[model samples]
Target: MNEVRHFWLGISCLIFKVSKTFRYVDTDNELEKQVGGYEHIVVRCPIKIVDENIVETVQKLPRGTIPGDFLDAIVVGMDMLIKKFGSSNKGKTHLCLITDAQYPIKEPYEGTKEDQVDIISQQMKAHGMKLDCIITIGKLSKAINQKILAENDHLLSQFSRKGVAKMRHVGTPTSLLGALRTRTISSVAIFKDEKVVQGSSEERLL
Candidate 1:
């Protein structure tokens, strides 16, 4: 758990350095229960990144006491982004999902996990929000679900040809750091042209 939390904090700080706006959501099952339900995906911080305090706040976020459903979390995140930047052509908008692919879809979901992924991908396409994923490997557990990981990789590849999504599978903390740094530095150029272009670092991952 510490490994996962620290990796995420490092990514958040790196993003804070390069991004003008940042928002965070914790999909922890315990948190969801306390907040009333999974539907209430809380934004731990505001949309605007004012200063270093945002980084500090993110750093202090609690580690998940229980596993969370990434699919449900993705749905809520997509809805928030769609509401906030509906069809706007102003700035680049993206949702980066960092996970270990441990938790699969649980009960109470509207449809099958594949169906949810399809819906989420379509919503991302319609809203014009890029979906980037940093899928950490071997950090959480040895029993990581291969099925979920494969499904997630497929979803990550859904819009890669169009530069709508990018994914990195990192097996160590050092690699994770390098991936996040590379992403933060290259994101603007990647999204500015609306296509990753040939020979780019992101394209090599596809």
Candidate 2:
């Protein structure tokens, strides 16, 4: 019998959805079928943040900030996945990062954006993981900003320079599903940057 491939999937969404749309659920189900035979761990982005200080705890997180600290969230999710799934001997675990931000990351604390990207890229290379970023354009077609596209392109270029493949531009669930079914992808750790990073950028096709 042929050995099944393995994958670690992590998905992140900026806008809190009060309800999952038809396409959203359909895309998730389709992705499950596509990876049915593989040993895979699926995780959603923005792992819960809990602040504990002796006598108090906080779970609520504020939103609507420039270049939100989303990379940190992604890393948290990836770490959980890694801990659950044993190391892969294949030299590379697959990661799929789904995001809707056009500019979602920046350089780590005391580091430049380029430095942060390089560090994350190197770390993934060390861990034998490959990443594929799926970006979802804004739902508001009328108010879509040009800066968003520019930022999105820059992000894709940065990842490509670091050796990721099939960085795709998707606007809807159908497009996302089409890309996932046709391409192979993975993800890397999100590092903390010195300042809020900005850029412009996802999907559920698969």
Candidate 3:
């Protein structure tokens, strides 16, 4: 788990360096305590990728807190984007999820896991919010429940079919870095005619 957390921080920083903008929300369920209490999901206001302070915050984020319900987190993140940008943002909005595919939806959600996944998929398509996921596999990968990981992959497949998501499974930190860089560049290139460029000139939450 420590290795996964370290690699996650590394990917976050790499994304920040290779993308025009970046924002992050840790999916640890402990965040609910700071938010008053759980309301199906708990998320902080998206941290704007403005300076080194954001990197520091990512590095300092606590690890091994109860993992938030994966599907609920997606729903809440989409809601946050809608509240901030409304329906007009279209393809400009993106939500990137990085996980080890080991956690399950431990908390109660509104519907069955299958139902929640379907709804989330439909919502992302309707709102034009691109969803990308980085599924990390490492020394601890064998401990992950195949059932849970399959469900997560199914959700990603739905988004992929809609042409709004990409999923990458990587085993090492170096490979994860390369995947993040490539995905960031490809995503940015969709909007710009020229070659992909990197700098914090726009706003994006991942």
Candidate 4:
């Protein structure tokens, strides 16, 4: 049974493992706490934001900011913010992005919910914490014919090394956003309700 009432005690955000490796290894995770219902996802974007005035003050430099150099500043800033949280009991921790902003040309692991659970669950156990979830905004496109694409045909077969990720075509205005609330790509967490269907951003609102 789902415990709806257990989720009412507000939320505290934890930021750890700012080592830019996406793996949380440090002993300290108390980063920041907010008095909300975990409505927003804390995304430590890989891109660093700089003040325009700071850049304008650098008169001696021949060139402006180097390409992708801002990412370092963001990483440092996020670490500092994480340090501020200071080991308090944050409700649920979700890893946004701990690496470069741009998607890797090749992904190290399948970015599925189940895959994420397995990979990060170990880290959570290491920290004596249970990570509720980590959400990253990215899209994937697929076209497959199960009958045509079969075994023993290397030239004609193309498959995700992680196997064909089960997908359900969710239609309507808030379909994509609503599906996220379920957290499981293969589960039915909501039902239709007139003009207002469930939203993928429901967690954000919760």
For this target, which candidate reaches the highest lDDT against the unseen true structure? 3
Predicted structure 3: lDDT: 0.47
Candidate 2 lDDT over residue span 117-177, tens digit each: 6666676666665566666653544444558547646755576788853466676645644
TM of each candidate vs. truth: 0.59, 0.49, 0.63, 0.24
Per-residue lDDT tens digits for candidate 1, residues 106-169, read: 5544666556566667676776666666777764555666786576566556546546567778
Local accuracy of candidate 3 as per-residue lDDT tens digits, 13-128: 22211111111343232334445333333232232332334334444444434444445455545655565556656665666666665655543436666565667777878877
Which ranges of candidate 1 are over 4 A from the true structure?
1-41, 49-59, 107-110, 139-163, 181-206
The segments of candidate 3 whose C-alpha lies over 4 angstroms from its true place after superposition are 1-57, 106-111, 182-206
Error of 3 at 155 (Å): 3.3
Task: Arrange candidates by lDDT, descending.
Answer: 3, 1, 2, 4
> For candidate 1, what is the lDDT?
0.44
Candidate maximizing TM-score: 3
In model 1, what are the clashing residue pairs, if there are any? none
**Model 4, C-alpha of 57: deviation from truth (Å):** 30
Model 1 scores worst on lDDT over the 10 consecutive residues at: 188-197
Candidate 3: clashing residue pairs, number: 0
User: Candidate 2, which segments miss by more than 4 Å at Cα?
Assistant: 1-68, 89-92, 103-107, 138-145, 182-206
